[model samples]
Each structure stands twice: as C-alpha cells, then as structure tokens.
Target: MSPTEPIYIADETVRALIDEQFPELAGRELGRRYTLEDQFAMRIGDDYGAIFPRLPGRDEHYARVVDLITPHVDRWTFPSSHPIATGVPGHGFPYHWTLVQWISASTAGFVPLHAESARPLGEALREVHTPSPADAPLNPRTGLGLPELEDQFSSLLAFACDRGAPENRSIDADAARAIYEEGEAASQDVSFTWTHGRLEPRAILSDQGAFAGILLWHNFGAGDPAADLGYAANLLSRDMHPHFWAGYGDVSEATAARARAFQVFAALRHIQIDDPFLMRMAWERLMELGLVHEA
Candidate 1:
C-alpha cells in the first residue's frame, strides 16, 4: 500500500494491538497486505488474518456481517474472525476490526470465466445460501431499489449513445430495458434468502485451484439469490455458467430472469461511471453474460 494512504497503519501499531488484545497470537510475521475501498487487511501469525474496515453508514447491523455469515456457512467460508478483546482504540487505529483464520499463501485467485473453475465456484455459492433470518442485516445495495436500478440502466444506455463507441453504440436499449423489466417482475415474488450481494471473482479464495474460502461480508444480507447469481453470471463465462448452475442445484424461470436482470445492471455500472476500461469490460461481460446478442 502507498504510504500516502491515510488509512495506512504501521505494522508495529498492529503488533501493539495484538499484544494488547490478543497477546497469545502476537508477534507473528505479517504476510501480504491488502488495501481495499472499504477495508485494509493483512495476514498475521500461522493461524489468523485480520481486517480493519472504513465501514460506512449508521447501520448498526453492518459491522455484524461476518458474525452473521459465519454460522450459516461456516463449512463454506473462512471461519468468523471473531472480535478479540479491544477497547478504547489503541495504536491510533481509527475503525473497528475483526480476525479470522488465515488463508495460506497456497491460496490463489478465482477465475470463473475459465471452464474448470466455474463449477466449483457455483458450489461455493450454494454453501452459504441457506435461509436468512427475518432480522438479518440490511445490505446497502438495497438502497438501489428496482426503480433506481432501472433508471441507472437507462441512463447508462444513454451514456453509451453519447460516447458513440462501437460497442456502446450498438447496444439495443429497448431490448436491455426489456431484460431489466423481466427481472424486476421475476424478483417481485421471491422471498429473501441469505445473499452475499457482492460475489465477484476477487471475493472468492482458492487452494490449489479449488474453492477454499470466500471473503468480504460487508454487503451480506437477506435478499434475492438471483441478484447474487446475476453478478456471477456476468463475471463467469457463458459456456461455463451451466457448470456454475449445475453445482448450484436448481434455477427456476423466475430465478433465471432475475439473474439476467441483475447482471444487466451490474454490467451497466461500468457505463454509469464512464470508466472506459471498466465500461469496455462491462460490454464484453454482457456478451459473456448472454445479455448481448449477434444480429
């Protein structure tokens, strides 16, 4: 991480945190460090990894995402990084933190677009999708309700038109809108299930090319599972998607429709921000997602 980042905390201070709150596990070597939009994470000791999140919003339940997901899919994900005893913010650490079992350097990145890895990715998703309690924490994505999602989709379509790029210019806005409408209608009746909301490839961890543990529970909540799969559908190759769904068990028509809808919006996100690289990826991902078709 750049020293320029304000969230950068010294290793010694982290060690101080360990000595103070988790002395038994203190003094372990720090492994790869991660600086993410919401969190700073690093590996420590032979057994534990930890994250300090710049958690947003006033939602009291947001902080408990790890706590909630652990028990539901303990066998599927890395075990919960239970909060160690820490009080009064020692070492100038500014936000709440949590620790879980460290995944070894043996772990590797998950690439769902590849055929061989897609099936395992599906199974990993299934393991954590059990029913969520009625009181499950709210996902911030809920802030982008169906109407907002639709509007964003339309707006991005217009942005595509404005850019006049071949890929963007070729998109059939009416057809894309139809996909979103179908998804909205399909999702209307399904009851909430536990959803990771954000299931991008970067979020899953692998050991020797096999699914080991999944991470990033900050957006977890009780919601539509199709929306979860929808994001995956866009990320994974279309040919490999069957393997993903096969591992995931059943997919009702409604589920499939919602999945397509969710993916359309997910891909459109790149256009909404107008990041050329990401926008191009989004357009390509839509084809892989099967939302775009050859004329």
Candidate 2:
C-alpha cells in the first residue's frame, strides 16, 4: 500500500453491506476518497456530509469535528464489518466508517454517538501515575523519548499556528521579540515524553482566557505537561476557545506561566511559517490579552 496508491472500498461493497443490514443508505452515493477525519461521508448530487463513530482514545481530538457537524440519519446503525477508509501503509492509524447525511448541493450533516462526547481523564491519570505492586499487570506499550516528543510538539504547534490567521491589528516588533524570547525560555524547561508517540494536552485555554479540557487521558508517560498547557494557551490566545481546559482540576502558577509562554511560542511558530492568518490571530490575541500594546 504505497502512500500514492488510493485505498478504495468499492461502492458496491459498501452498498451490499448497508443493504444487508442498514438498508436506508443503500442507494445513496458514497465517496471513495475520505480522509482519516472524513471516515463516513455521503455525496447526494452535489451535497456532502459525514458521520463519526466513537474512536478508542482522546474524545477531545474529535471535538472540533463533532462541534461542526450534526446528525443526519434517522437511526444509527453500524455500516460494515470493516472500516470504510483504509490506512495508507506509512500512515500511523486506521480509518473507519461513520454515518453521513447529505442535505443539499453544498451542505451536509454529521452524526456522532453521545457516548463519544466525554472522557475520564482524571481517573485515568491517577491510575497511570500511581505506583503499582510488582505483580500488578504491566502495560507493555512503548513510550516516546523526550527529544522526539519535543520535536513532534514543535512541528504540530508550528502547523497549527501556520493555519491560524492573525487578527485585523498588527503586532509590534518589540512585543513579537518578547513573545519569542519567552517561549524559548519556557521550552528549555519543559519535558516531552509520553506512552503514545503523539504529544497532546488534556486541556487548552483560548486567548479570551477560556479553557477546554479533554476528560480522557489518551496515553501517558513522563513529560512536561506544561508544554501542552502552553500550547493550549497559545491556541486559546489565537481565538480558539479554551473550553477544552475545563474540569482539569486546579490551575497552578506553573500552568499559568506555561500557558503564557506557549502563547508566545505559538506566535513565533506562525511567524516561522510566514502564515499571515496565524500571525494576525496571534497578534490579535496578544492585544486582547494585553500581552502586547501598540506604541
């Protein structure tokens, strides 16, 4: 399965499975090239829609996808024994099928099960961090090294910042320099190690000082949780909500400092990418948060 090669699950195959079990969508036109995030989608005439089944870990990872979509089908039914989207060889994860509804030529709706909406991060954290007896079940999962996780986090942060747009007002040179310096200092002190190869935070705070926290702890190991906190804070200052940071237990001075530092680091990431949207968004967030002031 080369990356360039298209992984196709034939329409007839999909239709056959649907017809045998869930006949309602049997005759509908389905798309063949759905991405990882675009698992179960339908195209009726010119309209496009998606459906998402509950994934195994990290409910917040799919929050944005769910937030933007609504249920379209009458009854929820599992479509096929196999996932509709196949994983490319180099790709790390498998793509699965979800239900989708086409509304019009340009619009569609997505349906997600309510069970996928929330997670239990706090309990998971306690379980993972607690010292277990020698005879206790030992999880055999491999963890990522600090350097590797940091590199990954840097890349992800840069990518997110590049995609984010700056606000209408521009940021001053002095303020920009300050943000860069601050982020660099913070990164040096932050750790990045995790049981999973990915570096993600359980919570995030937007520029408006709002918080968003995922209730599920996807994977665990030793790392600077502050780095993720910083990343989320940076995202929040970029106009994204901090709702993900909610219910993350008490906010500490360390968390607050890291959040501010990451906000700056996020701004620098946008600058590195030369992404006007993210830069502008970062600048606007700084202004709104009073991290920067115009001369």
Candidate 3:
C-alpha cells in the first residue's frame, strides 16, 4: 500500500501485532485492501498469507467460530487459525487482530465474478451450516427467532418513516412495507440451525471462477440457516439462484418459503441501513418475488 493510502489501522499497529504475536513474520510487508474497509492481508514471503480484520466485539464467540471451521477447512488448505482479537490484557495495545495463513493473494475479488461460482459457493456454505454443538455460542441477536426478527423489521420501518422514509425513486415505500410484512407473515415457528450470519458477497472469495475460500468467521453461529440465503437473494441476480440452490442441496417447499421470507427481511435491512448497492438489488428481488408492485 502507498504511504498516501488511508488505512483503518496504522502501519505501526499492524507491525506491533505481528511482532508481538508472530514475531518471525515481523517487518515483512503490510498491505491493506482499498475496497475492504478495516481489513488487511499480508504476503508472508509467498506461499503463506494472513489477514487481520477489525472484529470489535464478541471476542470469545469469534474464537469458537474459527475453531469450528478449522477442521472443516483443513482439506481446503485454508490458513491455520492464530487469531488474536486484542493484545494480552494490560499489554496496553487494545485492538482486534487475527492471523491465519492467507489462502491466496488473489482472492475472488480479484476478478469479475460469474454465475458458475454460485453453485460452489452454495455447497461451501452448506458445509458451514452443519449442526452446532450444545456449547456453541448462542448470541441473542443472531439466535433471534421469528418474533425478534419481526420486532426488528417493525422498528426499522418505523425509523425510516420517522425520517420521512427519505425520497428515492429506486425504492417504493409501500413496496418496501409490503415486502417487510410479507416476510414477517411467512416466518411462523421457523427452526434455527448453524449459519454464516454475515455471508455477504464480500465475505466470499474465488480464484478464476472457482470457490477459493470463505472469510470472516466472527458471525458463524447457530441461528437461521436461511440467513445467508436471504443475503444471497438480495446480493445475487435471479438467474444465479437456480445454480446456487443446486449446490445447496434439495430444498423442500417449506424451506423455500422460509427462505423467501428471510430474503424479504434481509432486503428491508439493506434499505434500513441505506446501503445503495444492496438496496438496489433487494428492491429488484422484491419486485421479482411479486412482493412489490410492477412499477
């Protein structure tokens, strides 16, 4: 990275973490991604790579997620986990940092993604959705059931309306409401399972159109398995859905219904957060699902 480049963590901080944790790799080179905010990946003299992302909370939970994934990804050749969310207490350096063998300097973001990657990504995510053990971290937020999700959506819509729902031709307020309500109605007594809670497109990686690796283990937990699919619904094109689901395994009509409901829920979240790109995709999905008016 250029000296002029803006960084989430200063070079000295990143260097200090490396020196303190894995001193052998200290003073190599530090590079930060322009597109990925608050994250950095370093080249450990080739064949080895590690990333330190700023995961601010849930340190104990994050550790478990990485532990669960370590065995699963062994065959995939992912980095071994040497994660350190912060320096040892009283060491004075308080920041989040984790070290794992970098999968490859060239990740999925290096190139334009294609539909073919959807299936592999589906299968990979399916592997991640395996049943969580009894001791698994059950964060209240992600472990939320239908009622919690409903309340969240209601609050989001109410907040938006309070702000005058801001004018935007891209999203129809009535349509947004319809989709949100429809999602809530469909989410009756839904079961929960292991899920990658925040599997947005950026969290996935690929190389030359093949599934490279998955990133960010902080959000993996026992919750709605449909959560990631909901994210995918708003993030991917309609044409890719079939291929993506094909790799995710057979979905019963009931599961499909729940997935659609979650998708609507996810869309409203995009709008609530004011993420333009996802908001655009979510609105398109709302229209395609007939949750929104044809206009």
lDDT on C-alpha atoms for all candidate structures = 0.64, 0.35, 0.57
- Alpha-carbon TM-score of each model against the true structure: 0.77, 0.36, 0.74
- Between which residue pairs do clashes occur in model 1? 81-99
- Give the candidate number with the greatest TM-score: 1
The digit string of per-residue lDDT tens for model 2 on 154-225 reads 564445434443333334444544544454444344233221112122121111221122211222233444
In angstroms, give how far residue 136 of model 3 lies from its true place.
1.7
Candidate 2 ranges beyond 4 A from true positions: 1-168, 179-222, 234-246, 251-255, 270-281, 291-295
Tell me each candidate's RMSD, in Å, in order.
Answer: 4.6, 11.5, 5.5
Clash count for each candidate, listed in order shown: 1, 27, 2
Cα lDDT tens digits, model 1, 1-295, are: 4543446678787778766777777777877677655566777767777766544442343446556755665365433233332222567765556666665533232322346767777876787577777887656563244655776677877876455444333666677788888878764555677777766545666556655556666577777777788877765656777888898888789878878888888777655643444566577776654455444
Ranked by TM-score from best down, the candidates are: 1, 3, 2
- What lDDT is reached at residue 25 by model 3? 75
